[model samples]
Target: MMRFILSLVLLPTLAAAQTPAADQARAAADALEAASNMLDDADGARDRVRALTETIQAFESGLGAMRTGLRQAAINEAQLTKKLQSREEEVAALLGALQSMGGGASPVALLHPDGPMGTARAGMLLAELTPALNARADALRTDLENVQTLRALQTDAAKRLQEGLTEVQAARIALNQAMANRTDLPKRFTADPVRTGILIASTETLDGFASGLSEIVTDEIEPAPVNLDGQIGELRLPVQGLILRRAGEADAAGVKRPGVIMATRPGAIVISPTAATIRYAGPLLDFGNVVILEPQADTLFVLAGLDVVYGEAGQVIAGGTPVGLMGGSLAEKGDELSPLREGTGTERSETLYIEVRQANRPQDPVAWFRTDEDG
Candidate 1:
């Protein structure tokens, strides 16, 4: 009887243990489903955002044209006003002359003794003057009418421009809301190890494809230099960082290989390669924010994935000049850890990728560095 009682109690305990496990499994499945749904929603949201941005750009262009039209209209109106005022003055002067002549002053009294001929000449002058004054008045009236018409048209255009701007603002607000709503989706999905790993692998695959194309281009096509000059070499780290990758191998993306791969802690400064002109300063695919420097006329030094570019294109930079700040990659978040490095301690660290190209072909960057030392 005691054994039977013990079996009954143990049976209940075992059933309860299975219940929690089942609940946990169900919860995980639900979470995964939610993540999948979120991905679909994110894609839709991204499309909407892109559409809205384009619409906003179009509206901005229209607004610019409207502004130009408005300015020209204003100038036209000013000129018309001046012309109208001058015409009014001429009309007033002619009216005064007519009133004085009609007020019983003899035609001879109106003319100076030394002025031109006889009664026949004076009468002829009076006839011409009367018609000339009337024609002047008519022309002024017509000009005023045309000015009013143009002003009305300009006013309508201004109103339309205002409406367009309002629509653009509304669209922008909607886009912002959509983007905000979808922001959490990526985070939720990426938090899972499986999903994160998949994303990283996919990124790598895409990068490899891009690298392959770059290699083909680099091999087949040579970019002629606009100018050629002295060799620049021995580039020191703009800031300290670990070398993530070297220039020798083609990138996994199958593009032209970078000269060197350097990763830095977030906020690390990127210094100039040498005294050079900044050829390019903007975003590049996979590289994030990038700055390209022409150290010598023919040499192109690329700096990619920066937080900010400090100089403008065409601006000259001196050696060791801070060109940009290193930014954290969206793929990973930490104190800018370099995947190439094997340590976990808190030392100031960075990863730098360096490359040297001559006549659009890859050259040994090590040789350049060594040559600088020899010089």
Candidate 2:
């Protein structure tokens, strides 16, 4: 009876113990899903940009065709003008010759030996020349009108092409921003728990079975040093804040993917996580303000995308040293009496990303985070 009572007492405690870890895992999963969704959005934006680009290209091609037509029309107009001038000169010369005859002979008499034949011949010639000249002039006028119509169409088309090109450029810029935001997502998580758990369980099962048979085992291991230059430990948080993201995750909120992220109120002092020499300090790709510390020979600790940064690359920084002041909406002052004003809520909610890499490959950052009990 006493043992049963003890079991009942322990059951609730055991259940409570499991809850936090499970909750943490669920939270991690949710974050990963968010990151995935952000990536999808980015991809959709990219597709839009691509489609717009294609449309712009097509319009440009059409514009080229319109230009060719304009050139051809110009040539046709010049040829028609020359032909009209020749026809006008011929008519003028014929009229002058008739005038030179000085009315001594009938114009019809000059065309034929007999009066009847001469009149008939003159009438026939005038009828043919008048109609031919009128028809040629009309043809030229129609061609000129057609050229004007085409010119107007080309002008309109050119304007439309310019607008399309402008839209394509805007879409491209948006796509680039979306791609940058998506990159932050993967950096927020360690290995996906579902996959990691399976691998770990499989390995453990294999190890257990092998141990029973006394089989020789070979472990393929990657070497990692815990400290850099015998002075700095592994990279850690320089300030107290929530880790908003880890390395290799996508950032749904940022204009670009962040290598790491920490959330603190804006205007909050940001510090170095360890005492180490800065390897790189400046603007990084997509990280507005960045600082990289070589905490160990094999590891590079990255603090980046800050609105403000105080340190330079190659400078030595001690752990807890003020590296910069956080900017954005989330920053706040400890007290109303304090002269320092906090950042706006939006800025205060901003995150700082942290990344650690060895040989340019990403490793899980959670392994380095100290457990709550240890702290």
Candidate 3:
């Protein structure tokens, strides 16, 4: 009977362990699915860029072929010229001799020599050289025509390539605009100044940021929560980038922290993960520029290592909202936006540091807040 009771106790303990393992497995599967979706979206953009590249490469290849054709035409022209040089000189002298005899002179007079035998020899030589001179002249003309055709092909390719480049730029603009149109999350919390200040002071470290969030009370009206608490592995990344560092990973300074480091594009737009109040928005020590956000009542999210930031302290930012623009080169010119190069997964212009804390204690963001991306 005692053994039976022990078995019963062990059965509940085993069942509890299995339940968490199953939840974690489901979370991991969801994360993978999300990541696949993100990759698919990225591929769509890459296809556009790839099309532009293919057009250019084909144009370049055509130009190269044309150049080769032209070179070959030059070689043909040179060979034809060599074969006909003597014929050209002979014809010139023959015409001069005939001119001296007058336009009314007979063909026999032009061939007049010291004797009948010499005259016969001259006529025979002219007969043989005539056909060869005619053939060489035709060959030289064909070579010139080929060279001209090649030149025209090269010019046409260059013109088409320029037009294609213009289209590529237009596509890039359209893509950026389309991406901009996607953020439509509704704001749920109002940022109050009194709370924002205390949050900022307490936000210096991950621990302090989490524990001191209640210093400023947030007013929630609609409570349009993204429900980040239950989302498990279905969280959207604040930015598209490769994860360079993960939570608990030692930094170059050998300090282990609860955050992930991401490599992003120049002038990338930073978005809020969930509807929340901006606890702080300004520069911080060693972080370049920092934007602290409070996503949950007891949770604080810290984003640092920005070149520039947008929005201000005490601002209510919605989930998927563009909180700020990253620094690096979104450095805008008067009215023109610079083009973004195609990502080969090697070109990262800026690094963003992300951290999550609940109730004033650092937690592994990778485990709590899941993203579709590597981080």
By lDDT, rank the candidates, best first: 3, 1, 2
Candidate 2 has an lDDT of 0.44
RMSD of each: 30.7, 30.9, 25.8
Which has the higher TM-score value, candidate number 1 or candidate number 3?
A: 3
List residue ranges in candidate 1 displaced over 4 A: 1-233, 250-258, 329-342, 345-352, 370-375
The C-alpha TM-scores of every prediction are: 0.33, 0.32, 0.44
**What is the C-alpha lDDT profile of model 3 across 1-375, one tens digit per residue?**
434422332222322222222333234333334433433444366443333223322322332232233334334434545654645675455445434433565766776657878888877987887677556444444433433443343344334433333433343344345434444434445567666566655566546644554554566554434356566456666765678889888989999877888887555556777777776777764577888887766667788887656566555665665555556643232111111222133335678888877767777777755565532
Q: Put down candidate 1 lDDT per residue, 1-375, tens digits, no spaces.
A: 434422332222322232222333234333334433433344356465445434443443344344445445555666777887776767567556545544756555766565667656877887888787657645555555546654664555545645554554565455456545432211101123343334434555323322232222111222233332343344554544555555666667976564766655444546775676655555555666667665654466666667666655455555665566555432132211222221342222444455555555556665555322110
Q: Give model 3's clash tally.
A: 3
C-alpha lDDT score of every prediction, in listed order: 0.49, 0.44, 0.53
RMSD, candidate 3, Å: 25.8
- Candidates 2 and 3 compared by TM-score, better number: 3
